[model samples]
Target chain A: MPTFRVELFEGRTVEQKRQFVEAITKATCESLKVEPGSVDIILVDVKKEDWATGGRLWSDAG
Target chain B: MPTFRVELFEGRTVEQKRQFVEAITKATCESLKVEPGSVDIILVDVKKEDWATGGRLWSDAG
Candidate 1:
């Protein structure tokens, strides 16, 4: 089972997500030789406030 | 330190999440003998349309 947990900024469209998963699935299948059906991808949309970098929240970074 | 990424169908209440994380942290502490504060849990809510199984999206499964 090739399970993927991807965290990115919020605001992506459904079309973007669809294309992303398709590409990810393709890459995983080719690299790991796993069936496309067995790959599981969970996308997490994180608000800027919830994510921090360099000890500062992304929302407050600007 | 134990980190967990849990993915499940969306629609869970905040109270449910609070309780679930508490329970999971407790279990992890006891099983792995790690400190409660050291446990990190990220919950991902998945829509039926975004998840697929057996080469079919969950939304299309029905």
Candidate 2:
């Protein structure tokens, strides 16, 4: 089993987070052939200045 | 700012989870001294049969 950890800017609604979790769960279950309940996903919402990709914070890059 | 992600087998209560989060937040704040608001932590809970550590599933290892 595999777990996905996602961190992004904190602007999405709870509904969006719910849908995203559902989608990631579905894809992981299908791709990994694990039971849906076996997959775990964690979403961390952060401010634009807090999260980084490629060593550049979101706010800095944007 | 940095994000801390922890994945553990499911069993902790809400209060325990809250305390663990707070502990991590405090430690990060003290060590990194980033604004408390700038740090985020994501906790992922998985079934015993689903999670693996050191290349062994929890159920397999335990």
- Candidate closest to the true structure, highest TM-score: 1
lDDT of each: 0.82, 0.64
Lowest lDDT block of 10, candidate 1 chain B? B52-61
Clashes per candidate (backbone, < 3 Å): 0, 0
What TM-score would every model get versus the actual structure? 0.63, 0.49
Model 1 per-residue lDDT tens digits across residues B1-62: 78898889999999999999999999999999989999999997898656755334465555
Question: Using DockQ as the measure, which candidate wins?
Answer: 1
Give per-residue CA lDDT, model 2, range A1-62, as digits (tens).
44556565677678776765665555444433458876676777778787666888878974
Q: What global local distance difference test value does model 2 have? A: 0.64
Give the range of the ten consecutive residues with the poorest summed lDDT in model 2 chain A.
Answer: A24-33
B18 Cα displacement, candidate 2 (Å): 0.6
- Stretches of candidate 2 exceeding 4 Å from the true structure: A1-62, B53-56, B60-62
RMSD of each: 4.4, 14.1
